[model samples]
Target: MKIGLYFGTFNPVHIGHLILANHMAEHSDLDQIWMVVTPHNPHKNKSTLLDDFHRLHMVHLATEDFAKIKPSDIEFKLAQPNYTVNTLVHLEEKYAHHTFSLLMGEDNLKSLHKWKNYDVILQNHDIYVYPRLEAKGPNREAISSEQENVALKNHPKIHLIDAPVVEISSTFIRNNIKEGKNIRPLVPAKVWEYLDHNLFYKK
Candidate 1:
């Protein structure tokens, strides 16, 4: 089976995430897209991150309606500072039958060479990149400044995809939560209900 690995902290899985996953699943040869919730990203600051288990649960809630999307707790079972290279290796060993591809935004794809053992990942697995605003769209200004991932030394394994645009961002949702603003529209209705009932992200 062709599985697309969609990695994120998923602080709270929202509509935008679902939209991207759905688009990938529909367009690609992926049998399923596993939303692997990383416990800790080596390059990202962990101070603002929610508990991994909590974030994973939120992903579960948000993905319950979609059959092709699944929330995975793979990183929780691994060592700290979960790196994509290590995770991919472990997944290949554990699930021998499944073929995997990495699904990510064009921004990340452009920065691929900077990641650990990027060469191995580039050669071993397919990388599916969805276009970013800077590449084609007029929405140059984002909710937060993501480094313009303009420099791309393309590898043979890379595959670019044009997933439907959904501007809703996870950072914007978190900022709204911090500012005591409503997150109803930012997340799916079920995820909104889960956040409300569980008192998640209260200031």
Candidate 2:
């Protein structure tokens, strides 16, 4: 099986995530899209993240109806401060028959060189990148070619996909929920129901 790993915190899976994953599965050569729920990311502040189980369940709810997409808790058993390269290696060892590729936004591509063993990752797996609209904010830092590893952009293993630009983010939904605003439309029906019933992110 040709699987595409779409890794994220998914504090609360939103419609944007589902749309992108569906697009990748339908439009790309991948046979399946595994939404890998990270238990702990080295680059993120873990304090703000929801419980790993809760986030994974939300992803399950969001992708239940999608035939080609499914939630993955593979990272939960891995060591803390999980790195992509480590996970890829583990997956390869466990599922030798299944080929794995990476699905990421263009913005993440800019910083791919900074990831642990990025060279090894590039050499072993293909990368499918989707477009991301520039975030407009005072805190946003502009990325220049000078700051990026230009070789990565032109790597033979890199594939630039024409997926839709989804601006919705988990942080946005979480903030809205904290403000007592309805984020029903931003997430799947089942996910919204779960969040509402549990009063998640309302604190």
Candidate 3:
């Protein structure tokens, strides 16, 4: 089996995340796309992040109906500030029969050099990079090509996928929730229900 690991903090899973994962599962060479809920991301600010278990549950709620995409809490048992290389190694050991690949946004590819053992990750597994709308400008194609050149440098393991880009973000959802606005269009129905029931992100 071929698995694509989509790792994220998932402060609250939103439609953008679902779309990306589903596209990877259906369009890519991956048999399954596992949304790995990272407990703590070394590069991200942790103060605003929801608890690991809560984030994991939100991921479950968001992806429950999807057959090819599933939620994983593998990083919960691992050390804090989970490193991608370590997680990949552990997963490889546990699921020896499965070939694993990494799923990420083109934005992340721009800064891939900062990640610990990034070279090792590239050497061991393939990386499927999906497009992300740039914040400063609308030139996605140019930015994507430039970032890909910097990160991949024609690496055979890196694959650039032309998937539909969803503009919604978890931060946008949270801000709306805090302002008592509707997030129905920004998240899965089940996930919206879960957040509403739990009063998550409420001020």
Candidate 4:
């Protein structure tokens, strides 16, 4: 079984997320895409982030109808500042039969070198990158070159996929909700209800 690990904060899971995951699963050879909800990301600010359990629950709601997509809270118990390489190691130990791959945007590729033990990740894991329209050309080129570099030694099985870039970000949705604006179609219905009931994203 091939699983694409789609890691994110997912403060509130949105449609854009579902679209990208679905596109990757439908277009690529991946059998399933798991939404690995991070408890805390070292790179991102936690000020506006919802609780980890809340975020994970929202993701579970948002992806409930989709059989190929499911939510994971594996990072919750891993300690503060969840790291990808560590998660991969844990997953490998827990699910030895599953082949894991990294699914991320092209922008993340620019900073892949900065990640903890990135070389080990590159040598052992495959990465699936989806193009982002908002990223600078240099970033895209860098991602392409990085893929090529990995391809040369057959090191990190990197693949660049063409998933539609719908710019509906959770940040934008949070901002809209903060301003008391309509966020009807931005997120899934179940997520909306959860957010509304919990008053999440309100400053």
Candidate 5:
């Protein structure tokens, strides 16, 4: 099986995340897209993050209806400050029958150099980079601009995907909920219901 691993904190799984995963699963060669819920992202602020179990449950609720998408808690079992490279290594050793690829956005590609053992990741696995809208627009220029860096530019392992840009984000949904605004349009119906019943992000 060819699986695409989408790593995120998922503080709360929203429609935008589902849309991207669905698009990748359907349009690309990947057989499935696993939303790896990171308990604590080393690079992100942890103060505002919801509990790990709560975040993982929300992901399950959001993706339950989708056959191609799965909610993963693999990172929860791993060490703190979960690194992508480590997770990939573990997954490969545990599930030798499956081939895994990294799924990310153009923004992540631009900052790939900062990741732990980033060169090893690029050398070992395929990376599917989806479009992300920037201030100037879609960040498709990174692929070409990085050509001077022989390691990443035109790398066969990096595949740029033209996935549709969804402007929605978890921050937007959380803020809307905190302010008592309807977030039905921003998240999956079940997720919205879960958030409402659980009173998440309410002031």
Candidate 6:
């Protein structure tokens, strides 16, 4: 089986996540999409993050109806400050029968060189890159940032997929939910119910 690992904190899975994962599952040659829930993203602030299991359960609710996209807590048991290279090695050893690839946005591709043992990651797995629109905000200018990584972008193993540019983000959803706004349309019905019942991100 060819599994595409879509790693994220998922902080709370939303429509944007589902859309992209579904697109990859249907459009790409990948046999399955593993929405790996990272316990700790080195780049993110841990204080704002919800409990690992809370975030994981929300992913479960969000993807329960999608057969091809499943939630994975593979990183929770690993050492903190999770790194992509290590997870790939672990999965390779455990699921040697399954071939694994990475599912990432073009922006992440630009910064790929900075990841730990990024060379090893590229050598062993193919990367499926999707289009992502940078949100224009204060002191931020929106441009075609995807075109910045010329060298990596042209790699033989890197595939630039024509997936839709989903602009929605977990930060956007969390801010609205805290303000008592209806985010029903932004998340799966079951996921919305789960978040609401638990009063998540409402503080």
Candidate 3 per-residue lDDT over residues 65-167, each given as its tens digit: 9999999988777876668899999999999999999998877787887799998988889999887777236776666576666657478998988998888
TM-score of 1: 0.86
TM for candidate 4 is: 0.89
True-vs-predicted CA distance for residue 147, candidate 6, Å: 6.7
Residues 1-203 of candidate 5: C-alpha lDDT, one tens digit per residue: 99999988887888889999999999999999999998865567777688889899999999889999999999888877667899999999989999999998877687788889998999889999887777225445655465335467578999988898989888888888889888898888888788889898886
Candidates' C-alpha lDDT: 0.80, 0.87, 0.85, 0.85, 0.86, 0.85
Clashing pairs in 1: none
Q: How big is the positional error of residue 111 in model 6, measured in Å on the Cα after superposition?
A: 0.8
TM-score of each: 0.86, 0.91, 0.90, 0.89, 0.92, 0.90
TM-score of 2: 0.91
**TM-score of candidate 3 to 2 decimals:** 0.90
lDDT (tens digit, per residue) of candidate 4 on 1-203: 99999998897889999999999889999999999987866567778988778999999999999999989988887866667888899999999999999998877776787789988898898898887875646565666676556453234367878789898888899999999999988899999999999888888
RMSD of 3: 2.5
Residues forming the 10-long window of minimal summed lDDT in candidate 5: 135-144
For residue 91, model 4's alpha carbon misses the true position, in angstroms, by 0.5
Q: Which stretches of candidate 6 lie over 4 Å from their true place?
A: 41-45, 135-150
Among residues 3 or more apart in sequence or in different chains, the pairs in candidate 2 whose N, CA or C atoms overlap within 3 Å are: none
Return the TM-score for candidate 5, rounded to 2 decimals: 0.92
Model 5 Cα displacement at 87 (Å)? 0.4
Candidate 6 TM-score versus the reference: 0.90
Residue 60 alpha-carbon offset, candidate 5, angstroms: 0.9
User: What RMSD does each model have against the real structure?
Assistant: 4.2, 2.9, 2.5, 2.7, 2.1, 3.3
Candidate 2's displacement at residue 91, Å, is: 0.4
Task: Note the clash tally of each candidate.
Answer: 0, 0, 0, 0, 0, 0
Runs in model 3 lying further than 4 Å from the true structure: 41-46, 135-151
